[model samples]
Target: MSQMRLSLDQLTGTNRRAADILLGNDRGGYTVPSAKLYPFQWNWDSALVALGFSVFDSDRAWQEVESLLSAQWDNGMVPHIIFWKEEKSYFPGPEQWGTTDIAKTPPTSGITQPPVAATVIERLLAEDIDAHRDRAAKLLPKLDRWHQWFLDARDPDGRGVVAIMHPWESGRDNLPDWDRPLSFIDTTGVGTYHRRDTDIVNKDERPKNDDYDHYMALVRFGRDCNWNTDHIARNCPFWVAEPGMNAILRRAERDLINMATLLGQDDIAARATARLARLDAGFEQLWSETVGGYVTLDLRRDEHATGLTSGSWLAMFAGPVEPARATKMAATLTYWLSQVKHGVPSFDPNHELFDSIRYWRGPVWAMINWMIATGLIEHGETDLADRIRRDTQALIDQSDFREYFCPVTGRGGGGTDFSWTASMSLYWAA
Candidate 1:
C-alpha cells in the first residue's frame, strides 16, 4: 500500500492547484473539470468541488455556492446546471426550454438539483475563520429558504424525504437504477434529439440508449411544457425514492435542521425533525431483508425490486441498518467483492447486464468505494473498510480518477481525470 502521507501530499497538490483558480483573485468562480463537457455552470458538481476550495479560501468556497444560489427561482428551486452570460449553444441551454413554463427568459428552474449546498455550507461554517464565517453567515439565510423549498415543493407529502421530479435531479444522469422506471413514459412525439455524450466519449463509455431516450424525452417534456410542475407531475416521470440521493437528502435535512435551529428557525427545525421520521420509514420500504441490502424503487414499477447496486451501502449514510439487515448487507457486499476482479463492482458482477466499461453498469468508482468503505466501517466491518481504503488509495496512486475499472481485472476503464474521483481521495482520507 502507498503511504497515506505521500498520497495526501499528492492530493493536496491537486487541491492547491485547483484552489489557486477557485480562490484566486484572477478568476471568478469557474474551475470545472470538463472543458468540453461542462464549458459552463454545473450546479451540483461545483457545489461539491467547492468543499475542496474551502481548504484554501473559505470565502471563495462560499461564493461558489453563492453563484449557484444567486440563480434560484422565485419558487426557491435551484436548477441543475446554469449556462453562463454568453454560452448559449451548450446543448439544452435554457433557450431550448422556451416552450416550458420555467423562465425561458433566464431558464432558472423551480426545482432543486441535489441538497449538497446545505451540507457544504454546514461543513464550511464549522471550519471557517471570521471572514469565511461571515460569508456563510450571509449565505445561511439564503440557503435556508432554498432548503425550505425542498421541504415545501419536493416533499409533496410532507415526508422528510424529498423526491426528484426528473432523473437529472439526481445528477447521476442515466444510472440503470432509473431505467425500468423511466421506460414507462411515451416519448413518441418529442421529435428527434441529438446526444453530445457519444460524440467525444465512446458509446460504450456512455449510458444505454433507453436511458438516453428517457432522459432526453423527459427534458424535452419539461422544455415543451415550460417546466410546469403540476403539468409534469401529472404526465411526466417522477421518482419517489432513490436510496443514494434520498440518503444524502436525509443527511441534508439533518444539517438544515441544525442550521435552522442555530438561526432561530424553530418551525423549520421541527419540520425537518418530522421529515427525518418519514425518510427513515421510506428507507424501510426500500430495503430487502432477504437480500441483505437496499434497492431502488420505481414508483412507476408498482412493486419493490432488487437493483443490487453499490448504492445499497447508502443505508449506512442513513445510519445503522437494522442489525440483522446490516449483517446481510455486509454479506451481500462481500459476495460482490468475491465475484468481481475489482474489490467492488458497481453492480453485482454476476448479473447478466453488468458492463464495466459503460457508465454505472458495473465498474469500480472511487467515490462509490469511499461511500462503501464508510458503510463498512459503520457496520463493524472495519477490516473490510481498511481493505477498501488501501485498495482505493493504491488505485489513485497508480493513476488518479479513471471513470471506471474493469469488473474482474482492476484494469482502469472508461474516462479520466473525473472531478468526483479526485475529491474522493480527500474525503476518504479525512
Candidate 2:
C-alpha cells in the first residue's frame, strides 16, 4: 500500500530467480535446502522469508513461526538451526546432534538466535488483510506462548535481558568480537568431523576447516549432553548477551503486547507490558557513554562486545531508548558505521579480529540493513534513514539480491540471488 519504490515487475531475471528460490525450494511447507555455509533451517532466515510470504499469504506467515515454534523444547528454548536431513556439506546435522533420535529433532541448536520471529509475525499481522489479521488474532495466544520461551529460557540472569545461545544464532558467524570470549573454551577435543557446507559452496567463502572443527567441538559437547538444556545454559562458549538478540527481544515484547490487545488477551497483554518495561530499562543501561551507544554482549562476562558492530544500530529498533541514550546511540551508529571502508564492517576495524569476508564478520546483510533503516525511520531520523534505505535499494538493484554484500564496493558477497534479500527488497524498499 505504501507504493513500492521497487516493483516486483521491475525485478531483473536474476532478482526473479532470487525471489522464487523460496517457492521453488520450499519443501512440503517451510523446509529450505540451504547453502552449505548455513545448511540448517536458520531461525532468522525463516522469519524473514515468512515476512515476504505475508505479502502474498498471511496464513503461511503464521505457519512459518508456528512450524519453528512448534519445534520449541519443553523449556521454551528455540534452537538456532533445525536440521531436517543428513548431508555431506553440512556438519552438525541432526545425525550429529544425536539428540532425541536424530530423526525426530525438535529444533537442533542447543542455543537460541535473535528473537525476530515474534516481531516479524507481529508486523505481518499488522499488514494483513482483515481476514488474516483475524486469523493471527486467533493465534495470538500461541504467539505469546512462543515469546515466553525466550523469556524463560534465554534470560538466565533474570536481568530482564536475554542471552544468546550461540554466535550462529546472532546470524553473525565468526565475528572477531567473539574471539576473545570463545578462546576460553578449549576446542581441541571436538573429534573427527565432516563438513557439508564446503561441498556446495566455495571453500574460501565458508569458515576454515580449523574453525569448523572448533564449532563442531562445542556442538559435539551438546550431543554428548543430548543437547542438555541445563549444561548449555551455563557452559556454552557463545552464550553471550547479543545486542541484536536483545534488541529484537525488545521489539518482540512490545509487539506481543500489542498482539495481545488485538486479540482481547488482556492478561497476556499486561505481562508483556511489564516485560517490555523491564527489558527497556536494561537496554538503556548498556549504553556506553565512553563509546556512546548500546554494548553487544561478550557472554563470558556478560557485558557488551569489546568493540562496535551494527548491533549498536539495532538500538533504534528497540522502540525507545531515552533521548540522551538515543543521542549517544545515534552518534555511535554514525561514527562507527563511517569508519569501515566497507561502510558497515561487522566488527570495529580498530579491533585486531576484523575479517571483511567472514560470514557475519563484516558482510553487510540486506536484512540487517533493512532493520536498521526501518528502525531509524521509526525514530524520525529520516535523512540518515533514507540514506541507508536508498543506498540499500541501490545495492540490491545493482548487485541484484545477494546473501550478503561488501558495503565498501557494493558488490554482492557470499551466496548470490538469495531469496529473503530479494523479497525484503520488495517489502522493505517499498
Candidate 3:
C-alpha cells in the first residue's frame, strides 16, 4: 500500500468505524445504499461502494460490480435499482414497475442512474491489475453495452448530451435543475400511492408530495410504454439533458477507452474515444455564463434551468475542459464554498429554492463532494480539492456517516449509517 493508504488505515477510530458501517450495509454480493431509506442495491451507489471496498477488500469490491451486472438488461441498459429480494420498506418496488414481464432479469427499476461503473472499474484495475484483470475483461462488454444503450436510447437527436427521462435518473431527484421541466409534467391523472421513503427519512428532507406525484406520473408513463426505450425517449414528459449525467457518462466513456485499449479491444476503444469527444463538444450547450457553470437544460422547454446546482459542478469531473472555462468554474466553486459552512452544497446557497436541510436541495452529499473534489484536482485546483476532502471527512467524523449533511449546521440528516457515505469517507480519507 502507498503511504497515503497506510495512513488512512492507521486512522484507527474513523477508519474502523467506516469499515464497520460498510460491512454492516453489505448484503452478500451487493451493499445497500443505506439501511432503511434505500435498502436495495442502487446502480451508482453500488459502483461507488465498490470503489470503497477496493481500498481494502478487492474481492468484495469486484463482487459488488458483478452483482450489479447480473441484473443488466439484454438491451444493455442497467436499471437504477435492483430488488434483489422482496422487501416492503421501499416504495415503487418491482410490482409498480411492472417490468418483470419484459425484463431479462428479476424485478428492477426500468430507468437508469448515472454511469459511474467505468470510473469504479478504472479505480479497481489501478489497485490490483493481476487480481482484477480477468474480472475487468469480463466487465468490458457489459459496460460497453450499457454505454451504448445510453447513446442509442437517451440521445435521440444524436446530440452527445442525453436527456434523463426521470428525476431519479439524474440521481438528484429534487434538485432545482429539473423543477421547470417537471412543472410542465401533468401529474393530476396519476393517482395516489403510499411513499415508504418519508417513513425512513424526514418528509421535509425528501422530495415533496407534488414532486412524488410527478415522479410517479413519469414512472407510470414509462410503465405504460412497457419501459420501451425508443418510446420513452420520443415521448416522455420530463426529458432533461442535465449536466450531472452527461459529465459522468463522458468520464465513464473516457475510462472505458483506457480499459478497452488495455484489453486490446481497438473497436471499443475507438468508439469510446469518439463518444467522449462528442460529449465534450455537446457540453458546450449546457454552459451558462450567468451561472458561471454548466446548468441543466429543459430540452422539452428549450430553455435553461432556473438555478445553479451541485450537479452543474459535475462538468469538472466528466473530463477535461478548456483551461479558461475550467478556471472560471473553479472560481465559481470557490464562491460556493465560501457561501456555506460546508463546501459544495447541492444547491447554490444564494438560490431561491435553496434548502439546507433538504436532501438534494442544499445538503452536502459526501459522494458529490468526492466527485467534484476529484475533478477539481484533475483540473489543477488541488487546494480546493484538498479543502473539500477535509470538509467531507470532518462532516462524517462529526456527524457519523449519515446519508447527507445540512450545509449550514453540518449536522447529519436523512438515513444514518449510509453505505455510500461510509464508502466515500474511506475513499477520500485515503
- On TM-score, the candidate that comes out on top is 3
Clashing pairs in 3: none
Off by over 4 Å in 1: 1-27, 85-90, 99-111, 129-131, 158-161, 238-240, 262-267, 375-380, 411-415
Every model: Cα RMSD to truth: 3.9, 3.1, 1.8
Q: How much RMSD separates candidate 2 from the native structure?
A: 3.1
The local lDDT score (0 to 100) that residue 278 gets in candidate 2 is: 77
Candidate 2 runs further than 4 Å off: 1-18, 31-40, 101-107, 336-343, 349-352
What RMSD value applies to candidate 3? 1.8
List model 2 lDDT by residue over 1-430, tens digit each. 1222234455456444554665654644573534435555767788887766665555665777777666666655666777655545655666666656532554375656777877787777666446566656655665566567666666656677676655566667676656666667677777676666666666765667766665776767777877665677777766667677778888878888878788778988998787777788777556665655667656468565566677777888878656776676566567656765334555665556665666666667767877887788888777767667666677777787677776666777666556667657656664
Range of the 10 consecutive residues with the lowest summed lDDT in candidate 2: 1-10
In candidate 1, what are the lDDT values of residues 181-237, reduced to their tens digit?
776777676666666656656787777667766766777777777666656555666
Could you tell which candidate, 1 or 2, scores higher by TM-score?
2
